[model samples]
Target: MRTPHSHNFAGKTRVSVLLACAALLAGCKKEPAAGPVPGGDAQQGLRLVTQYQCGACHTIPGVQGAAGEQAPSLAHIGRLSYIAGGIPNHPANMMQWLRTPHAVKPGTEMPPMGLTEQEARHMAAFLYTLR
Candidate 1:
């Protein structure tokens, strides 16, 4: 005994319910991990940052006297999806950039920091904690 109007109303209700369910599922999706790199000590990395004088050109949080305006602020480096103008912000890429900025992106403002592999690893571990 349903009228044409009632049939249309039921179809609209079904579509609305389906849309709500899809939105809920999308909201439940997990994000990528943002923890420190393996075998890289965050404390050591912090010390290395100071030792390397990174504060001279970049503003880094949790670091005293690191308020340089020459480079970008590294407050939330961990949550960033990309860095160094466009490179993916993975641990390996971060380490490579820390070791050789010019090689990663020629003509970039970041100069060669002369960091060893282990040092770069430690630095990356520390930088990732900015989130």
Candidate 2:
């Protein structure tokens, strides 16, 4: 039997099925890898953080007496999408920033502490574990 209400019901069912399929496909998508940052050690990184005295200008968790208000808090830095609220939040980018904050962001208050490549890598490793 054909009726106006029956046609609307059929259209609604088709739309519902399409939406359900789209959701199922989205759920099946794989997530990005969450492994340790390459060539970086969290423990060594933590030590370097203390050695560099980063706590003096920045608030860092797990570092005693790192309660600085000059810079942003690094409690969950790993979860941040970008560094300095501008650059992408990736290991390579982070290392570069740590090594050369002035070059990355000119006229900035953060100074170049003269960190070696190894030191930057270790610092990046420690920062990535904040999440």
Using TM-score, give the best candidate's number.
Answer: 1
- lDDT value for model 2: 0.82
After superposition, which runs of candidate 1 have C-alpha atoms over 4 Å from their true positions?
1-35
Residues 1-131, model 2: lDDT tens digits: 57999999999988976776586575532321222478999999999898888999899999977888899998988878787869878888888899999888888788888999989998888998887
Model 2 C-alpha RMSD vs. true structure (Å) is 12.9
Candidate 2's displacement at residue 27, Å, is 8.7
What lDDT, from 0 to 1, does candidate 1 have?
Answer: 0.85
For model 1, residues 1-131, the per-residue Cα lDDT tens digits are 49999999999988966776586575532433344599898899999999988999989998888888999999988878889779988888899899999888999999888999999999889998897
The 10-residue segment of model 2 with minimum total lDDT is: 27-36
Q: In model 2, how many backbone clashes occur?
A: 0
Model 1's TM-score against the true structure: 0.75
